[model samples]
Target: GGVALVIDGKALGHVLEQGMHHAIVRLGSVCSSVVCCRSTPVQKQQVVKTMKEALPIRTLAIGDGANDVAMIQEAHVGFGVMGNEGMQAVMSSDFVIGQFRFLKRALLLHGRWNYLRTGL
Candidate 1:
């Protein structure tokens, strides 16, 4: 069984100071998901960048506001939600969607088809 961790901005700094592999392994061993709350833009970006650098798997960041722009841009695949938040995220993202629910179709259908076609 795994846990869900809720880490605030200050805690994120300490987590990142450890080596990437150690951090990933330690986190994976205990938690299935880690939600960072009240994190700064740089902290958000660091999380994405750390995952991208430490793991072989693709990393996707989803956001809808200007505050998320850095994190979205740092991810391998950035998904932007078009909403009242603003357009900065949309401008920086690799893919843009009208609503958050459409993310299901984008990732499961179109994403899978593209993966099959490209053989990536």
Candidate 2:
């Protein structure tokens, strides 16, 4: 529910590229890359697979709609926003967020605590 900003693809892509460039300059390496305007489920899966092939680490996918189900399923960690208009996505997700901001805390703090508690 706290989500905001719906920008056109061209503008969103430009902003994402700029952010990636800034991160590269500030971090002295590329921390992430931006792929713009992937308009299909299969395309999204391919993007995820490509990134995984490029990097030797796990990937996470988070989304809130039916269009994102495939990508979510492809990732090591998948989260879906619930209590919104996202029934299908929630059903397919590894974790469902009833409260959106709780997701950040869950991944950043609580999730770590849980891992430590479980010794996993």
Candidate 3:
């Protein structure tokens, strides 16, 4: 029930040129998922921004360094890799966690709680 469109930078740019029109259409015909990969964090952020503009879904961008800043800011929610990197990503993130395992609670439980708290 998924489509793994593992594209690189060039192909990602092509797909995004249309404001993720292609990905959206492909997603519509899928069983329920699509995993798109890009080369750099900046490119990743661009893709997420385009997808957000074209769709109503929320995006979660994660990274460990300054390189990840753009994507982190681009997402509806961002998770910075803490401990491994300094305070950079953690400071920029909506919520901070030290381990990947903690992301489940941060993303699932805290995300909903924040949304409700914000009245969004």
Candidate 4:
């Protein structure tokens, strides 16, 4: 169990490369804390790119708006929340899902299958 941290955008510098990577790395060191409440679309993508670079993370970005498109594309697995905000997120996503509830089984089954296939 972990807490989610809504990283304050004010804490980030105008040049977010270094700052964003540090933030995501710190967040990843903890167990279940998610980055949230971000106000910028760029921030969403920044977190994913940072984590992907600093860790062996296979990220799943879920979104429902045009703002989420870049973030979804930045992730290893992009799940779109269909009909929530717009179709843009879904159009750019790897998969479109109707409900958030299904993510658990999707991840579980996908993880299991990948493990068997790759032995990772």
The prediction achieving the highest TM-score against the true structure is 1
Candidate 4 residue lDDT tens string, 1-120: 566655666554343755546755776657464554544788788877877888886888888889999999999989998875879998999987788787777779976897799984
Instruction: Give a tens-digit lDDT track for model 2, residues 1-120.
Output: 232223335554454456543422233224443332544666556555555665666777777789888988988888888765658888898998886777889798988898899995
Winner by lDDT: 1
Worst 10 residues of 3 by lDDT: 28-37
| Predicted structure 2: lDDT | 0.64
Order by TM-score, highest first = 1, 4, 3, 2
lDDT of 1: 0.81
What does the lDDT read for residue 63 in candidate 1? 89
**Model 2, which residues run further than 4 Å from truth?**
1-29, 32-38
Score every model by TM-score.
0.78, 0.65, 0.68, 0.76
Error of 4 at 113 (Å): 4.2
- Pick the winner on lDDT between candidates 3 and 4: 4
C-alpha lDDT values of all predictions: 0.81, 0.64, 0.70, 0.76
What TM-score number comes out for model 3?
0.68
lDDT of 3 by residue, 1-120 (tens): 454445677777676675766564455344243444545766777766766776677777777777778888888988887776577777788777787788889868987898899996
Query: For model 3, which pairs clash?
Result: none
